[model samples]
Target: MTDPKSSRLLDNRWDDAKAAGLSESQLLLYRSNLLGSDKRITNYGGGNTSAKVIEKDPLTGQDVEVLWVKGSGGDVGSIKIDGFATLYQDKLEGLKNIYRGLEFEDEMVGYLPFCTFNLNPRAASIDTPLHAYVPYKHVDHMHPDAIIAIAASKNSKELTKQIYGDEIGWLPWKRPGFELGLWLSKFAKENPTAKGVVLESHGLFTWADTAKDCYLLTLEIINKAIAWFETETEGKAIFGGAVTQSADADKRKAVAAALMPVIRGFIGKSESKVGHFDDQPAVLEFVNSADLRALAALGTSCPDHFLRTKIRPLVLDYDPARDNLDEVLATLEASITAYRAGYAEYYERCKHDNSPAIRDPNAVVYLVPGVGMITFARDKATARISGEFYVNAINVMRGASTVSTYVGLPEQEAFDIEYWLLEEAKLQRMPKPKSLAGRIAFVTGGAGGIGKATAERLIGEGAVVVLADIDEAALKTTEADFAKRYGADVVRGVKLNVTDEAQVLASYIETSVQYGGLDILVSNAGIASSAPIEETTLATWDKNISILATGYFLVSREAFRLFRRQKLGGNVVFVASKNGLAASPNAAAYCTAKAAEIHLARCLALEGAEAGIRVNTVNPDAVLRGSKIWSGEWREQRAASSHLQVDELEEHYRKRSMLKLNVFPEDIAEAIYFLASDASSKSTGNIINVDAGNAVSFPR
Candidate 1:
């Protein structure tokens, strides 16, 4: 039964556990195992699962019982009842707002012993407080891999709306523990009929009068998600695909046996082993896919899978045409190092002083060249479930390709999600102080509203921002205002000509040394010189190229070198105008340079992606900054020469954009931040328009 059940057996186990009359040990094991079934279901034990038991309370006036919940390191699948700490139900409910004086990192430790008298051998699930707050008999907290896959995607809430369509109530991603539970209790109170509440990016919660209903509801909800995804993406299988070779039953069994121990180690089961790669055509095809390792390059379906899948799959790079163990070993070692480095970087990016950093991968999948896929989990159950999620994610992405290219979340957004406090709280430990924190990002043309606003947002997110412009007086005046707003370390003022390569390079070095490293480079320095095609001259072209094209390259090159040497992925933003995309009348040279810089940014985006470095360009249409070319006097002079009024000049340009709102530097910065963060790991070589829908007219 388990063999055929594979990943689906989890649903059955939950049902069977309840009917069989669970032992104290069996009950704890059942809850833990269920929680471990999905990485998203419980990450580093981010979620909590509990069972009610009858017991005597000495101080109680009437007879009452308690609940035993999973404690620290007592992974759900293997957890014993002894691993569960008991807390009196009434006392647990009475202890409200116990988190006031406790540090978030230590909150788990401080609260565990206070709520339970049995002295749990492990730390209580952080959400124990929330579980106690609710009136339900059974409560389960799971990140629910399927749920997060939908949540972390672009406009996930809207996607959920399209999928579930009022089937579930969705909440924004928030810091978990006390607040998360409180939020849920309040929400549950408001919506009395919700079957389950979907916590965006966090996970899902379900409850019922009986454990069977709750367990079935878990499947029903996830299956609803599965069905919704299927209906919306009709005929697109998340995992099923074509295979290049026929399955050899003998070879399959041998492979499964060889992988059993490793698989069991991962999912925490011994008899569990690899199964069904033989039954699935896509699994076979994926193993045979060209550059299977490269295909595995996609990040996990969800972040917690990073704990199991170890961030990516091991590419079988094995030569089906010939045997190559040395090459395989070399590739394996390289993969190990790369994975470790990524973990290290994540640790440094969001680590907290009190928590120990994640030092090793908890799970991995092997992608052999000719052979099919093999995944490792603490037990066979986890491995099988994770494999399904991976296979499904790959298929969905590939199928989505048929409809249109898959565009990932913007980089900066990915960074924000990956490093978000709520998500970070799910982990047992976090990274130390951010290595990139306090670093200053100097953006030229900072007096421009977009540049200024980008600086402001980055400062607020914890990075120091330096505003630089050729307008020395404006720089100094703006510097004073920002310094007052963000404090001395968070804001800086620099007056340098980005057009001067020496000055740009000097400033880059000085800024790096001053802040320990340059975290962001916003090359917004440019001048626009408009001329009719007939009157265009070599001199006019040189001037535009000098500032917009050449200067941007020089500054970016210096920043890249510094970042590369430091081995930290720094972000770079280029401020090009929409003229780069569609030509406007009498602006040939300016448009050409802006277009060239735009192309340069694309090259950086692709080349810099692997190093964690990012580069993006913003093209705003009608930024009314005081450029000598776009100044009122200059416009009036040109309009008089053309026998047109000044108002006509403004109308002509304003009407060019669809929305007719003048584009500003702030608009550009919003897109720039999206490209700069880790949230956009899969996004690069993309251009975002800040022109109030002007790009729609570009003949797409």
Candidate 2:
């Protein structure tokens, strides 16, 4: 589900008028979207939906049956028509001739490519057979929390029969593959009246002859489970009833802010990992509960949750009542050390001879009593989604333990799925991460043209950006635009006045909490002024010094603190000006302040060298287009000083350059990108002149 953000009861969002003109295949897509729209129905990338539609064969004009199912690694909630894998139903049925038995079920996946109906490139998921063997024309295989709660209970078969009666049958747990498909098919055939079946320690499956019916039936079954749990567990305690009080909202955030970077530092010694923190009601209740450790240790039941969240979360030793944050900080490395050892032990005990060499032993999810849950992964989305999966697991545990003894999938079975050869192959097949993947950035003056361009460049390479701007309105607009283009998880906006020391401190704290810590800081925020030396007022001089000089120091100081805290090293690129290197006519205040900015970068470079922090400068001149500072009197003043009209500023700068080319915000952004990235790792305290070649303003 795309996070409705508000909890709404499960209501059918299907508009009959909307689905009226759609073809059978289109209707199937429509049905899948509605089911996926609510996380109450299924998770982000969990679950599968299918439809057996009649289509004219691409080879012949004859109508044939084609099974359209959700492709591997695709999310049903956001899936499109092209996201499905289509195969001839007849060809799938013929697979029985080659089926050796349960032992050869893994081989069935290899033959699936030969069954592709139209040469569609989307790979079919392993759940393909489970959907194919079902008699119904439309099928939904969902891992809804409400339904999985029942499925994961110790007496799941009994509970399934009790809650759903004869309409829903129960089946023994079998690893998902060709064999599980046969089990579902045989059960459906015997219980002809059954509309669905509950797979123990797995999830729910509902089917129908038509698309809408199947969609509604899936919702009906899940809602019934939800409603039953509510009634049965009405006055009962959950997770042994929250043993500790939840820290108030603000306190929880402060605690999270303090802990995330420290934990990130310890865990991120190898490859970098981004972090996500959640202290929502559900998470707080789980972490503060009496059974938090025991239930967490048991792990998750559903295969999708297990795979996304790992075998179990690392529950820290924290006392909410004592408020032992410093203690937690001091012992963080030890806690992580213990967790790694535990993960290694689990891997050794559960691993098969052919199992992939013990994957990263670090735990993905971390549970703190008062602070809430912190999850880390290769990028922001994975970290956030890992938290979501654990939330799903928490909901399952809450409901199951209240109504029945909650049971987790066995250790052996969880290991087999986690280290499955096909799963490892899928991991190996993932595309190489972008250049800036797993890096976090803080961009100042982020609402300005150069700031926006630099942010876009960095984000394109996969860095998560925190956009800080003095203008709140422009900040909102740029943040919204970036969020729409790059996804809401990758970019955030903060209103910051670099001159305000308190605001800068608060903004850095916000950044640390929002994203564990920043690896890059593009200090680009500024204003421009033009005046004769005698006419330049104390106010003008102070304004220039406060923003251009003082602002850089404040932001850089905070960045240094966070960099040292994370122990991840750092990169700082100051967006100074050509005026800083060479004197400009009449703009003494601006030129002097810009010079201070350059010298500051050099000083910081010397201090940070031992810690591996790199500080560099990018000097840009006469960037007329899309420059906020240039849009003001600065443009008219510079043009007047150059003996040209305001409109001729671009041409004047272009012709004045040694290369006779126009300097632009994008050109400056390119220089900043290089310095911010590892491309300039070896060259610190250096300067890049992006002024289309100005011999006079060149750095000596």
Candidate 3:
């Protein structure tokens, strides 16, 4: 049992906000953070809060009321003052009249924008009117998981009454719109003593004259629901035991390695976009449970989840222990076909004329019973958000099942929200994503200067990148740094000695399992060896050939196998040097290895042409800045050979180029990105020289 005193402790912490004499808007912001900071209260951008404050109307020189509400797409936990959209109260209240007669589409396009008070252009949340209609000075709305468990239960009405008695108004599952707002407003008027309103199949709403009171009431009500659920479900066998002891790590990875690419290929056939995949522990637990099919078939825990997870997750028939890869993939294909057919029928049964065009029938979340759950989206961020919500939904549904039967919104109600104009507009409002939004990229030598730069560039363009390098320490540091910028899901690090065939093959398999498949492979790993033919030791030549020549072959071979299996065209980029095209004196081993690497790329290009795979090479010359090849004794020898000081070598290289520009790591990175992207789609078996203007090294 949660201590009731714990609720008091939280309330006491808010006394500091009151002591600071915060303005109404500031208090609302502070409390919004307080509510949003707790995942139990809201997840991601799931909730909104508002404050009614009196402000001077600049044009009229009179004090008028304004509703400051959480702006669209703004998370309450991190919202600043500007994150709140300000609206003229009198103007917005008048919208209720126009809303009554206007169609939902018309209201979204015409009326919502006209009611704004401030010059800020962010669209107010769709739930704006719900806050405007409420008479409280402070109102908070949250989709607390605990409350959702109760609100989505079959016995929600009776449960609501038992929990809050007449102090709370229970509104049935009505599609959120002008009508719903009006109904809630009317209910508050009739039930004047009610402290909050519970929207069935939705969430909770609490209000008070002060932000502190409103916040405390929300926590109080949510705690009540939690206590009730804990008491009711105690000793109940709600969750089934695991179907089998969790598979060993290698087995789980092998299952993902075999299944994710095929699933990705199947889904990609329906849409010509990049795909994303995730396999978190929560997903594994839920999917591996014996009751997965029974629980998942019941649909999403709430209507709002449909926006992220869809109506139902597609459950594939997969048993890691008994099923072979080919059999699992075939079964998955048939399951997807059946899912589409069922989705089309469901749409026909529920869709109205105003409904938006049907979205693709592919399920966002796929449950592979023995392996885990994999979520698909157009980008990594959305896939992760969908995964997070599904995990929460699973927990809520499990709790609801333990107490009373779990019940989601009816199909028509889900359709009404899923295709709602306001919801669709919110998605349309987002800025266009980068060109490589859902693509996966693998960079060898990723801990080195050029490789790190290329990985960062790919991530900036929105590709999920896997950084593989023999240097484990550097690889870990680079991964951690990239995670700080993009997120852990955006960049993964793998220790890879590219010359080791087993490690090379395992890296590709891991990439396929983690991100469905690879689209771009930058084979940039190599070692620099400079020696005259007579003086060159066998060790020098062998080491250079092993990493520079043989490493490229190993990694590329694995990449080719996976690309052929996926049947999706991919890009391969070889990072050769200008010396490869025009040899430098005393650089026999290095030049020979690079020349071999370049030729290997052309051969792969010819072999991959039929599969639509494009192979290219980037030859960068005198890349002194951040170039590991130009460090230590090699720098002295190269400078001595050119009869220049160590520091002057960079200037010499700069002047040597026709453009007289210093070639930095980023310059090489740009060339690699161009070749990897669709910009060079028509060009393959091509070499891009990043040597400024190397007339001698320029491709014929």
Candidate 4:
């Protein structure tokens, strides 16, 4: 019986698409989105879909049959019509005769592009031929976790026959290319009544005359297999939950926090390599599973996954209570060496004369029993994607094991896919990431204008940021908004009042426990006060000093403490003001507090220098708009002191600068980013004046 949940999802999507009056291409797009929206069905770029349509050739103005398939590098969920590469069916079919018996690489590189019907240059998916060869008008292909579990099992063909009956054809594992397409075409002709085809150790394919029919058929097969696995695994314990006692949890956090920097440093020694460590709930669960060592030792479930996660995950032995950090590091270094040696051996076992050069020997997924999983790559996005895929694969393995003995693609097959020339080309085609690809940053007052702007800038450069603010409502809103703009893993929010020493310490502890450690700290929290020297009350002066000066000291102290414990160098950038550099009339409280904060940074820089921590200050002038400090009675007071109206005060400040440029919060953020990154590595105890050429506030 089809699973009710799966049936409901497919029916709702189909009905909605039809109600929207979608055309065939639009319906296909809608169907692809439905499949891609669920990671259980397909990951970021792991699937393909297509529809057959007749369109007029631009050059000849003649109607011709064209197959529109999902193009490379486009996620199915957000794909548009242009994301489908149009190929003439007749031209694509003609390639069968021209490139018969060609190697996979030669066929893909030489004859594939010639089949395109349009001048638009997007490359078609490698499985485009399989879609075209099917007789049906619509075709869907995806690596659904359920379907993969069954397909990658020990006796895949027999299990597929048991679940899908004779209506499903089983194709042996073959590299996706001309040969696989030809084999599929032959199978379809022989078994004309087959509803779908299962490619062993790869994925599933379903085709029908309509898009809805094809999509529903795909879902039905996957759901049926899942139901069978569930029934078979009833009352069986496949894996145990993590040991979550308070002491165990504390030990896990401590080990993870201490070991992450060492692992990062080891991997980052090479210029081309970088590493990111994550212990999210799913990773922790997987690492703590009772059979992780045995299960992870098996090869990857499918060939496509091998391109992202290597053939086998590197599993490390770590006992939080028994193993000291130094001992763990030594063992980890030895394990990494063994992993590299094993990879080299596997390459030698599989490589032929035509094989591509071996890829870097770094393992994408690292499994630590108590500490959790650490994913590594040259950049943050790849590392995250790898971790996500491994989590899905772990679930697949558990389900498969409960039903029968779990098996995966053989080592040789995995090697072929990992070193494929097309995969290498895809990597080469991607643009280089920013310098801070895997770094973590913590920004105080992040719900405010300047702090939010700085956090956004850091995220743009590929840093994972934690935003701390005292305003609970605004903090939650900003966190949700940022998660929507970027991925949820990119930015997090913490409710913190920097003036409260307890809150400040708790925020840093949470940062270390969650993300392993912090790399950059932007101390941007402060309050502004304006009063003549004689009129300023003691309370007013203390309030300004407590937040502006004392707050900076508290956050910096915690950050430095964490850096010393982890033994990794870090960066701290203080957001001071131009008022601190040169006294502004009638703003004695704010000016004096900022001046104290600036000196605090300098003193910290002196002490932190020996530990390789760099500290600096950025002084911005008159960022009037979107600034909380420039609002309320302070705005009126500043305008009155400048002899201008409130609205005209902004323009007056802009024109006062020698550059005549309006300083925005983003300008200050850029200055802070420079000091926080390696661009200003050699310089510390320094100040950058971002006042749009304010001569009086210039650094001496």
Candidate 5:
């Protein structure tokens, strides 16, 4: 449905007022963020930017030139000033004396630290030399989709000449290092009148005296490629014009929902993996196309895309016309086995003597015809970012294949980059994964204080969370706050009245669509009512059971269903109450419902035992600080029942407990965290009383 001839794609967001007072390094940061703001300009963490600024040396107190460039593994869009690496310009120029030619170019990375300015420890990246040796005041190296579309074409050199005549130059594909840095310098020197050069199968490099001028030139050149492609491919068929019809939105999601957990289980056999689903227009257009298999086989040409998405994707054996979902599921295991074997074969064939052991053989990208793409990674953000990179590759394929035969990076070269010693060292340097790192959880009363606290704990241990609550306003606020504190990828929110069974199922489906599926379910949604046995009506009793007892059943049933489908087992934690065990006077309805919740969890624990599904309960007492149950009449009723003022409830509860301490939301959250993690994997079907050592509430 895209209009090919509609040309305006990127906007220059530079503001003169914004740039007027910034220092040179600050200006460079501003420019880098501006160019990185759009995917059309660069994929996340793909490009490097730099500026040459004169600063007083900390030791000599004399003005000296320094190269300020993005540090290793930094993303331009979200980068702060601290994310840049500063190196002495003179020291960088002096590294040439020790250069040992192309064979030892990799040795150049080790020497980068020797050139550090002011002892800045932000480690220089491999791209640092590419920016440092440019011989211009400001430089930009971006991998825009349109420009890469041209760079990735079969006749890229000829296309470059036709597109810009002598204004831009082109270079053959070379692994980025000191040798390539010299190549760029020679090209810039040889073509004194040229503004920039495109590295074959790589990206574009542009430079200017001022940061704004470099920013403008980069945008202008990419804009030209965008316009040219719009005209050249205007009437041409894209990806051979979509051989398979795309399933409607609902059907596509349903298929994705069904396949994700199965794929996740296989991929996480060794280490757990999180999933991301993308059915964007571009993704659908490519996946449903006639040329998908052939093109995907060739793999991604750019190094960034190649590294993030692996050599190639596994194409699921699915045809929407037949709607044979069952058949697809049946063959999924065999397909994954074959993909892993092929990946191992690739590593064996292409690895050097010292190459790292073959990494996880499973493919990172999964392509399903008539459905969409699914990506699995060690965590949610990486999975989502990996998918974004593939989309960039898809765009490149669409543009290049329409105009010229699209070409992928050669397999051997890709292997060399994948297993490069420098990259391996970086991988080894990564911190250990958190306890719950690839797990996903759903909190039913996610907007309430305890629900929010539980979510914070889970996310701290690296679990992505989906929050479902009936309070629309509170849900939105909590979602925004969590998204800000954590990341947008780490949390999501949806409205749900847990008592509604259909609504419960729909919410679970939405969670699958949002984050593949669940591994943990926190059943914390409830209500408390206190009425004398004589005055308690049938309505009050039903309401307490509906929200506290039956609602738990609805959510747990759906969780078990998903757990069976994933075959990855599951974790379920119920927030029961101290009242569930000891008879509390004048609160028969509330106490009975809480008791039912405890027994229900025990029943589920027994039923799910064979499948590795663990169910447990946390019993909290008088959590008055942030309990929604205590926000209504329940607070006054409890205080009156205890013969204390509303303000004196905390003290009363503390004095009444054997430990002489009051319980809080955070206390319950810690217990839930323990149950949700593997630390207590062998201790389910039990209760953790977070009630300040109340003997009556203790499990006998």
Candidate 6:
């Protein structure tokens, strides 16, 4: 149980917050504080917190309860009322078990009630159920540092008992949604006296009848754990040269005052609450300790903690004698490898069910030979707090490693947290997209015709396009043409053959770095080759598919690598042909390749949707302007061969489409432009027809 003395102030603070009138700004501040404490509880935009506010319902003719939770892309630390999507609490609760044994559109989860707001409220956070499950005026759910650290250890249950004693309860990580809520409710019933519950590998949950109580109780629990750690380690608090501070609060206040300006400038914010940073003397001394090299290896305790602490921190030590920076980095590399290998071994031994295995470390820690440790947090304050926690964790682990091997939570346990329901529920939180401004795009085969059109249109619409193609001369000419029209930086020319894996990989590396990162990929490169079915040769078929289909794969895969790493989300567009839908006589190999291209794009769309990468195909009918197979000589020969006039040949193709308008290269280009822009943000795995409606003659 928590020592009453250590938690006395926390309990008092709960009453104080409630008395503070819960203004909008205070509610936001309180939400930030509560969510920022745990990495899994919330990451860049993971879990959400809400306050029950009464509002008049337009349809009901009566005042009703509404919930205000963080909106689509808003971070909790500085989330305003605008960031929270206001919804009728009753309407949201009704969805808990309505569609049992079915999966509706994940995006539609909040659409029902969102349509009722005065200003269309943004989509609600996906884990709205978990937030709703807790019967509290103010609910706070965070993957707490102490809780995660313990949960991630091999003997997590034992660690929980040793550190928290009987103060907190534990819940096996389950998938989030109605099921998790049901699970928690059942567990709570079984342990009525529990202060809060720890969702394994997921996060911590602590709610009160009031927001203030929730906040204070959370701190009380954390402080109790901190005190226990200190007592076990006999860690001494350190204080450095100070201009003269009589009290601990005074010292912390001065440091916060100095640091606030720098942080504000870093984030471009003028107003921010400076959380008091009373760095433990033991932490400071440990950061300056001789074993700093050994301490830098521990990564973050959980996943999705990047927004706060970042992937890793620069560990600094003030000692000038620490000259082997390479050795320090090398040790870090070794530790990371060991960590992954250990995780895999744990998985092998513990995994007996069909559950998916852990993928990556949720967090990474870095120690500077002479500098202090840095921890990964999703926000600035969280990162700062993580640094404080890292020092403590480091001291304990170092001492513990000496006693017995510091085994992390076994594979099964880590997988439970990594794939925890609450964590997965965060995946369900799909925000309505805003504009595509500040995004980079790269279009292959972007010299002339459709390729040129795509590059030009994308550039005109505010995207920076890296126009690449195997035709070096064409690429240069296109670059010159666009540069003269849109300035040199609007479009850049890079010689690349998408069919060549090395070239494709190089192009991605160059473009990603030059553009800060890639946001859109347009695989518009393909050569047209048409022949009678029996006349098509193996070499010809291979050549067509290699560039038309496999080439798209290489470029798409390379883009996926960078997009996944950056986690900014991305879009991919394939320039398939109308031949994919309906084949014309004498076009066997070409039609086959085009059909394969459409299916490939669909599969990528399905796989990448979860990562926020939208994949779609643009199928345009025959555009005579730039196709290699539709030159002036060929057009005239085809007209004579078919015993029809040149004009008649063009007329026949144009009339094939329902729209009956000549489909130019520019027309196809526009379709690609729309797919790449924010205008079609919700579109994915869709095949848009730019054939002037010709391909619709026969539907799949």
Q: Estimate each model's TM-score.
A: 0.45, 0.98, 0.93, 0.90, 0.98, 0.42
The lDDT values for all models are: 0.60, 0.90, 0.82, 0.80, 0.92, 0.60
lDDT of 4 at 443: 98
TM-score of 1: 0.45
- Candidate 4 stretches greater than 4 Å from native: 1-12, 16-20, 100-105, 239-262, 269-286, 319-334, 348-358, 370-372, 378-381, 484-489, 509-516, 561-568, 584-588, 640-645, 655-661, 693-695
In terms of lDDT, the poorest run of 10 residues in model 5 is: 1-10
Runs with alpha carbons beyond 4 Å of true place in candidate 1: 1-48, 51-55, 61-65, 75-80, 90-95, 101-108, 118-122, 142-148, 174-176, 230-234, 237-295, 301-304, 319-364, 373-700
Candidate 3: stretches off by over 4 Å: 1-21, 101-109, 239-245, 270-282
- The numbered model that scores best in lDDT is 5
Candidate 5 per-residue C-alpha lDDT over 273-341 given as tens digits, one digit per residue, 9 for 90 to 100:
889999999999999998999999999999999999999999997899999999999999999999999
- Model 4, 30-141: lDDT tens digits are 8898888888777777879999988889989998998989987787877878898888999888877666465433455467688887775878877787888887899888
RMSD of 4: 3.4
Put down candidate 2 lDDT per residue, 1-700, tens digits, no spaces. 2122324347778899999989988998898888888887889899999999999998898999999999999999999999999999999999989999987788999999999989999999999999999998999999999999999999999999898889999998889998898888898898889999999988999999999898888878887787778779889888898788888877887888888888888888777889999888899889999899989999999999999898899888778799998888898888889989988899999988888998887889999897789999999999999999999999999999999899999999999999999899999999998888989999999989899999999999999999999999999999999999889999999999999999998888888778888899999999989989999999999999999999999999999998888887899999999999999889999999999999999999999998889999999988877789988899989888888899998998888899999987888889988998877779899999998888888777
Q: Give the better candidate number (4 or 5) by lDDT.
A: 5
Looking at candidate 3, the ten consecutive residues that score lowest on lDDT are 4-13
Please give, for residues 545-629, the per-residue lDDT of candidate 6 as tens digits.
8988899889999888766755556799999888888866666777888899899999998899998899999887768777645
Global lDDT for candidate 4? 0.80
Give the runs in model 5 whose Cα sits over 4 Å from its true position.
1-7
* CA RMSD of all predictions: 24.0, 2.3, 2.8, 3.4, 1.9, 17.6
Instruction: Indicate the residue-level lDDT of 611 in model 3.
Output: 92
Residue pairs with backbone overlap in model 2: none
The TM-score of predicted model 6 comes to 0.42
lDDT of 5: 0.92
Ranking by lDDT: 5, 2, 3, 4, 1, 6
